[model samples]
Target chain A: MTILVKIFGDLRKKIEGYNISDALPLNLQIESNGIDTIADILNKFSIEKEETYHLFVNGTYSGYNKKVKDGDRVGLFPKNMSLLYKWYFERNEDE
Target chain B: MAKRILRVDMTKLEANFENFPADFAALGGRALTSTIVAKEVDPLCHPLGASNKLVFAPGLVTGTKAPTSGRISVGGKSPLTGGIKEANAGTTFAQKLGRMRIAAIVVEGKHEEDDYYLLKVTNDGTEFIKANKWSNKGLYDVYKELYKEFGDKVSISGVGIAAEIRGAASGICFNDPEGLPSRYAGRGGLGAVMASKGLKFIVVDETGAPGVEILNEEAFNMGVKKLTNALTSHDVTKPGGALNSYGTCVLVNIINEAGGLPQRNFSSGQDDRSEKVSGEVKAEEIKKRGGVRPHFCSPGCVIQCSEVWTKPGGKDPVGVLEFESVWALGPNCSIYDLDVIGELNRTCNDLGLDTIEAGDLLGVAMEGGLLEFGDGKGALKMLNEIKNKTPTGRILANGTAFTAQAFGVTRVPVVKGQGLPAYDPRAIKGIGVTYATTPQGADHTAGYAIATEIMGVGGTADPKDTNKSDLSRNLQLATAAIDAAGYCLFIAFAILDIPEGLEGVVDTLNGVLGASLTVNDVAGYGQQIIDTERAFNKAAGFTEKDDRLPEFFLKEPLPPHNEVFNVSDEELDKVWGT
Candidate 1:
């Protein structure tokens, strides 16, 4: 399954050899034979579990445990954005 | 030690220092300004006439070690909106005033003659200097001349050509750390009020001035320590936070993604060129262009969400490019060219205009077919018209609502005569309640429900939820208190998530005033400020009708989310419940 991913702010530097273009969301086809959460995809990208980042799937803030399907637009932001935006990121809370 | 107040009677051309009134002792910043304006200035008095007064005050902890707490409040009856107004700016001028133990500077009674004057304040005394030489000049030039006369250490606050002409869109400009007149108490045409008094510059020299007297030294230290920890530890306020790294422009992408970024004069919520103008792109460009990133507007600011943007070759240096400035000039006008936005922002500063109002007016003008949408060069040309005070410029200089009325454009996005900011209220429904109900006339910072609805500062509320009147009111109250305290509103981000940080803010106030106030008391203080402002607005002939989003918002559906401002007027009235 393929999903588009974007990273911003400190997360860009955290990524190894991060290209500037990576800041804008680009498609990533991750092998997902089984259903997986955003956390799983982040882990596959070598993102540390303890890292303070906000995840948004399909333009809405999503929990790490939220499922990530193919073609979902996932955005990763540092913990700074959560407070900057007043902790409003978890858009899928109702879901 | 008693605080001092400087009362400058422009009518008499005399300045006097007096003891800060015991009745107004507890107040500072917005609370002080609003309270004074509410009590002193007649609501029905013409804002540009002799009856209106301009009051400048620093926050309680402005001169202290409170991180990001240096903000100055400028309050007066608004010429643009015909309502009470308090516009704030984060500049070293406030800190210098606080250090001098000056509670407020009150400018009253218009000068009989039209000759411009400068109100110069120092530790020695205050004087009115004939400043006609700098009349009708850009603030940047005025700042340079003032800096040369007063020295680099002195703080300068002045108006520009727009204010000299008493343009309704004019704002009082203050010098930043770099002595650039880029920081502004930019709202409600307060600059015009200042100019009406025949005052052009307020140069503050704090040398040999006594610093603020702390009531409780121990509490103050503890409060500073707690706040420092919260600010440093928080991801947003910390050194490597989004603001420090990318500056405020970071929100451009997020808001665009949320489908709330106002584009093309509120005709759309989303723009295809959103990524091009995002903070990420700006930051990247700044880095590539050898511009200064992570710039601080005032001294002792830890967050430093300000930045100095320059042209690609670094030939032309644009003063701090803020998120709102970028959004207003870039996306709302359908112009994504950063250079053009930068130039327009610089022009707004030079002309002593509020970029938000100026950009909104341009957008409305575009809607009126006066200019083509997405024409960056054309936008620049129209701005030049404003600088030259052309007929078209005069109309635009009056601000968004006025321009709309003149052009017979119905899609004007404004509340109470003030233009709506970057976020389209139709999509960001929580903020819509705030825009509709705030006494400040469609100001985002009045309640800032975007924190909860989008950023989740206090608590998460669905962006589409119209049942956020209570949340908006609470945030508005808290913000009032924060504004009064002179703490940068950004501190709310840290204090909201960190309970101790909130306590630290309260403790700072307690230490400064030597009073024991609980967290609940702060809320009460904020409520009192709101009540005072509301009373002033009411006395000024404002009613339930004034607290409303324009009709277009309710009837017209915005793009992406395809949502209208579904918040009911009854709910908006309930924002200030009986």
Candidate 2:
């Protein structure tokens, strides 16, 4: 089973080919196989291991260490976008 | 060599070319403009009065090999804010003026007549051409006539229908590369002042073959190479080249996801239309229409952010579309159509106004029930009234803050009486600090902490934290330096987050000026510039109390994201003082 790893912003370019490339709607397709964690998935894409690249397990922001399930649609994004955020309410005792 | 200053007393109709003082040699753009405003123009004088002086300045590196230094600063007492305002624009014309060795063009006093005229300049000298007939012509047609009469390479700045009516909302339009009257010195009603000077078009035809000569070619070329290389190799500057490819509209989705996207005139922070309004959409549309061409605004521009755009399947593009314009007309008005957004953009360029301010003003009108939310046609109707100078259009022409006040709308996003940019200050707490504290009200580019949050320009920070004070401080300081150089702020996207990038830029500046300046010198110069602007504001009747986000942003908890701007006023007040 393969999962669709969607990247946004700079992350999309860092992991270039894993996207649907077309002039009409610039998209990318990155193959995911044996990528258990978001970290592993990113490693496969040759993305640097940094907290800047936050993961979204289908519209919900997730940790990099979170387990990636087969067929799970992962939306990768930057951590801080604007000063406004719902992620603050996520109860990050460590942060 | 830099150009000599041309001072024009609108009252006396007298003018002379004077050299810039040695002390003012290091200054450019905001620094130069702000200093002139603070020193010469009375801060307490009425913004539209003869006491207020308009300073047009190109940056320190403008005539040199430094990239993207074609930015021109128009500074004066703002009629809308009643405080000092500096609106920056990018164009080849600014460099042409710089090459002409004009450090600054000061327009002071007012003409006796209500009739408008034109100000034309060439490499030899400047001229005030009489043209009361061109007063009410639409900007595009005016630009076409100017290009036809002068030449294609002529850089022209003129007002449109809005300015002739003395709309406090008008701006000066500049011709982009495609010869469209797209780019503008858009903010704080400077165009109306130009019109008040009995002048309309200010054209610089630098066609006489002698380009600006470098005082030290070796140094200038060295600096240009280092900065250009730094820009090309960086991540954001290369593939995710936001400005070159998508322009500023790239922020639509990212801000939406972060929950800072201002929808329908800041009613909410998130726009569901994010997917549609995102930079990806713009890029694709440009590709489909074959309008995806990019060009630098001036000579030696490394980060080519400014571009001429046309309608898909249409030859004439509305204007140079940016993120601010997209938000101002699109989500701000509940209209998500990019074509309509482009039309509104063209309309603003042709009419000579700022897109963000116009959108905010229209949003105020929408709240007043003059038009429904997302009513594209209705918004056009109001803009048309402004073009034609109808009674109602006069109110909308001034700016969003004014419109909000006139209609008793409570949610007007402004600081120091000027309209806010696309970012909702309340949600973006760091930027809120910027919005409140910057001399220019609610200007996103003033500090632009988003460079870190979105693209990690300098470095990534917790955008959600109200304690991102340090980041805000650094960004504000750095941005001031960047603005002074007259380089597009987008250049930071590549330079920051890269090592030796600062060193490279420093190398170029040293080369251009033949002065051995360091990175610390840049920071110090930036601080001095900020200090000057702050002092100007202080003397101009601003208090520490004026450094504040709108009252509602602090109190109101927005939906979709139940967060308020939690940054304390004390923290904001300490921004520059610290």
Q: Number of the top candidate by lDDT?
A: 1
Looking at model 2, residue B542 earns an lDDT score of 88
- Give the distance in Å from residue B207's predicted Cα in candidate 2 to where it truly belongs: 4.0
Query: To one decimal, what is the Cα RMSD in angstroms of model 1 from the true structure?
Result: 2.9
| Model 2 stretches astray by more than 4 angstroms | A1-63, A66-95, B1-3, B208-213, B449-466
Each candidate's clash count:
9, 23
DockQ of each: 0.37, 0.15
Sequence-dependent TM-score of model 2: 0.88
**lDDT per prediction?**
0.82, 0.71
TM-score for the B chain of model 2: 0.94
Q: Residue B109 in model 1: shift from native, Å?
A: 0.9
Please tell me which predicted candidate would have the highest TM-score against the true structure: 1
lDDT of 2 by residue, A5-83 (tens): 6566555556445453332222334455667777777788777656244455543345677776766766565432211
lDDT of 2: 0.71
For candidate 2, lDDT tens digit of each residue in B520-547? 6765676777787888788878887888
Please give each candidate's TM-score: 0.94, 0.88
